[model samples]
Target: MGEEIGSDHFTQDDFREFGERLARETTLIRKLQDEGGLSDVGPVIGLELEAWLIDHNFFPAPHNQSFLARLGSEMVVAELSRFNIEINTPVEEIAGEGLARMHASISETMRQCASNAHDDVDTVIAIGTLPTLRETDMSLEMMTPSNRYAALNREAMRSRGGAPIVFDIDCCTGAGEDFTTSYQDVMAEAATTSLQLHLQLAADRMRAAYNASLLLSAPLVAISANSPLLFGKPLWHETRIPVFEQALAQPSPHQRVTFGSGYASLDLVEIFEENLELYPVMLPVCADAPDSDFKCLKLHNGTLWRWVRPLVGKSSDGKPHIRIEQRVMPAGPSVLDMMANAAFYFGVVEELAEYIDAATAEVPFEAARANFYAAARHGLGAEIEWFGKNRRRSVVSVLDDLLPMAERGLRRQGMAEHLIDKYLSTIAMRLASKQNGAAWQLAHLERHGDVHRLTADYLAHQKSGLPVHEWAI
Candidate 1:
């Protein structure tokens, strides 16, 4: 909510200024949510894919800057790490068999990526947490060499009582960034990575997608758990879970547990308002702004809600745009896997938009929230409330019911049946196999507790580009 593109810093007054800006922004979705009758719930869809680069040995490679310079910055963008790269797919409308086209584009991009890295780097694999990730690899030194990232990191850490912005990943190294173990274990293993998927949605459905996102979040995490280690410490199915939340958290007095009062995101208002309230402007503006204005609250109000938020921006036709951007999705096993993730989510949006009352009423928002945390805490093994009486259902059961609903919803949108089946079924298979990225990474780490060894094994599997269950078997 603070800033859409990115930012370098924010002063005390920027908050108040940005807050006022929010009041002035007339987003397209507000028209529908407020007026009710006719709205654009247009079958619009879009995607942003982010991935990490690895060396021939299958470890994080610091090639992002060089690659972007050589290949150009139109498609691939910079990520948190200089070793990481991001691809933004042109916005595609999920009309008819539109999803197929998006899938093909992603495939082509992957091929191009491989071709570009042919001899220079070994490969590029996508997963939530790179199994090979090491504490040394997460240092601020490797952070994307951008003024924006550094500024934001500096300000963010500064706000939280001067804590070291926690660049350390949880490894067996005694949970401290400073070396606690012997010299032999210095580097450990560090190639764990992820593919983050960003989807764009119409504003009216924003609220529905927001809530449903929480419900869908767990399932996606369960399926895409590729991050399972910090240094040598193996924890959580998707170890990225704790790290990501902590990294983006509002940095209040309490950063330990996310549940309850920490984040005031309940209904739409809390989500949007709070996002606008917390995040400091992270982008460095160039010659774009007519004048260099300085106002703390003013900048806060003027900034848009993007990624970690529901954003407001102007569209091609001069109309305002409001979109809910989901940042948690990790990179993939394949384009098919990534598209399936998108499809499953689209189905949820369709179902929720079409039938809001039933979803919200039947499943209390509180229960929905609880289910999400449970799924994240414990992957497929976690139990969920199905019909009634706290009936425990495996992650599979939840997806089984939801996958069909997604398919139906897609069909309702006039999407081709074959496409829906092909895509949604992938999600089903993902849950059934229980060998998602996280699951596979965890198993790999357990087999080879050494971080470096775990990372090497992860690279071996990624080099093969085999499905998790396929690799596991």
Candidate 2:
């Protein structure tokens, strides 16, 4: 979805040609995997954070074009909506000071972005959903000026046969009523933002790492829940999940955005094969690149938007590698909080990937799926089935048991103990206080009964560089 196309309209012949190229690329991927051609330069870490630009009035600011022009940084780019922009970090090795360097890079980029947006925009903030954002702010006119977004909206509507995308979400633990609405295009997706973490790994470890991500999704979402209120109504702890899923809803057995069919097997190439068989190509913009690049396949995979997505790319040494894009976590309440979430994910996934085969056998894929929605709905208080146990356990308890394993995983990776502590301690404090971003937002709204004031205070705390756990209600 990042790549742009020449035209929004596609012909039958275009689809045919793109499909042929995609198939050939899939075959090439299999051949490479069988021949041990994938890169072993692993576990590289990177991230993309989608954030909002707000005006002085604390509402969405549609001035990203001017904002990006002023910022003039390659790390910052436009997102689906003008009110949103994505900040990307440089790829680093996940050992020693790698995590700290990521934090530094993002912090510097954010500083520059905030400094550059003094004109039409008030300042930049990173959160799951803006409390003051309204339905009118998500119209097609607010979409970023890009051919890719234009084609996505056009193709998505075509896939649904012109049916309006229906968004129906029930508040699980809030006083707000159930919310139901519809949209004629995919603009509702703009209302939700997230922090997407990337971990590049060797092809041999891809299957285990992918399965570990699926199993860990529940705890990750629960601990990182930052989105609670949408349009003045308190919704799920992390409302971004349902909003993004239903925003692009279509009448197909294979949803464009999904948890996936089941856990992966021995070979990761099976996923690409399934992509070929099940999903219809949304953007048939054929690339003029080599077959080894897998351009068409990559574009098609991008459209799928799996919660845990697999990416194929080349390393600095020019050898192919696979990476897992963890998309469950929201953008943030603070940079420190976001980095802590990344550290927990990296360490835990590394440790669990070592024993994923046995782990998956004990916990069924259906249970993992159930755990995800449960956590998204109820946050830290969510009770999820763990380790094939007949009874469910609170997400907090599950995380407490896993923190030690994560510490061990970081140690095994040769990360400095102090650096590990710096990140993991933030998670510990959040768990102990039970004051994640969602909890803080809900509590503040309850006390003040004002979304605008809630947002204003949230921004103040964010600017103060305090983690959500430390923010006062």
Candidate 3:
């Protein structure tokens, strides 16, 4: 979905050819898995953080076109909306100072992006959803100029038989106040941003890692809940989850954005096989690349925005490898906070993957999915069923146990003790204070009763480079 297509229009013949090519590639993937053709790369991690370009008024500034041009860096690129931009970090092996290197790189890139923005644009801020954004701001005119985005909007509407894209969210404001509206276009999906974490793993370990990511999604969303208010109403703790899921709704048996149908088997290719079977081709932009490239297959898989998606990519040596993308967490309160979230994820997933098979058996797939939504709705206050527990436990308690396991996992990966403490301690403090980004935002709005003032204060604290727990509400 990040890549652009040659054209926004597609014909029946294009879909036919793409389907044929996708089937061939899916079969080839199975053959490769059987032949052990995937790369044996150890744990390598990278991230893409989506952020907003805001004006001095604290509203979204739709100037990413000129912003990217002035910045002149490959690390920063345009997103679904003109006001949004994505910052990518280089891949780092999960050992030694890899986490610190990612932190420094993104921090420098953010500084350069903020400095190079258009005069009308204020500094770029990373959040799940900008608090000052208005509903009228999500028009088709605000979409980033790209053939891929245009085609996606067209096909999504086509799937719904030209019905208006309805975004009806139960803002969960406790007074039965709901945010219900319809969009002629898919710009509503653009309103939500996220921090997508990619972990490149060996073919043999991808399954365990993917399952472990599902098991951990609840606690991760709880601790990192950032998007709370949408269009001035107090919604779920992380309203981005529902905003994204409902914004792209279509009349299909399978949802384009979802947790997943089920856990993965030993053969990770089965996940791609489900893509071939369940999902319809939204963009049929056929490629001339060979079957081994899996261009069409990858493009099709990209359309299915699974919360924890399995990816097939090429290593530096040009060998294809498998990776799991954890897409549950939101973009920031600060770079330090985001990096802490990343460190915790990588460490815990590494340790959990060792016994994910047994863990998943103890917790059913439906329970994991339920836990995810529960956590998204309630943040740290959400209670979830943990493995080997007779009753549900609060997300805070679960993290209390998981943090030590994460430290041990980082130690096993040979990560420096200081770096481990530096990052994981942020998570520790967040749990202790019970003040994630959402909690801070909600508290600020309660005290100040002004969304603009809240956003301004949030950005001020973000620029201070303090974690959300330390930010004064």
**Model 3 Cα RMSD, 1 decimal:** 1.1
Mind giving the per-residue lDDT tens digits that candidate 3 earns over 297-369?
8899889898999888898767888788899999999999999999999999989999898888888899999
Stronger candidate by lDDT (1 vs 2): 2
**Per-prediction TM-score to the true structure, in the order listed:** 0.79, 0.98, 0.98
Candidate 2: residue pairs that collide: none
Ranking of predictions according to lDDT: 2, 3, 1
Candidate 1 on 216-273: residue-level lDDT in tens?
6666666655555555456555555556554544456433224323222333444444
How many clashes show up per model? 56, 0, 0
Q: Give candidate 1's error at residue 388 in angstroms.
A: 5.0
What's model 3's lDDT at 358?
83
lDDT of each: 0.56, 0.90, 0.89
- Scanning candidate 3 in windows of ten residues, the lowest lDDT window is 168-177
Runs of candidate 2 with Cα error greater than 4 angstroms are 388-391
* CA-RMSD of model 2: 1.1
Name the candidate that leads on lDDT.
2
| Model 2 lDDT per residue over 23-136, tens place | 999999989889999888888989999999999999999999999988888889999999999999999998889999999998898888888767599899999999999989
lDDT at 466, model 2: 87
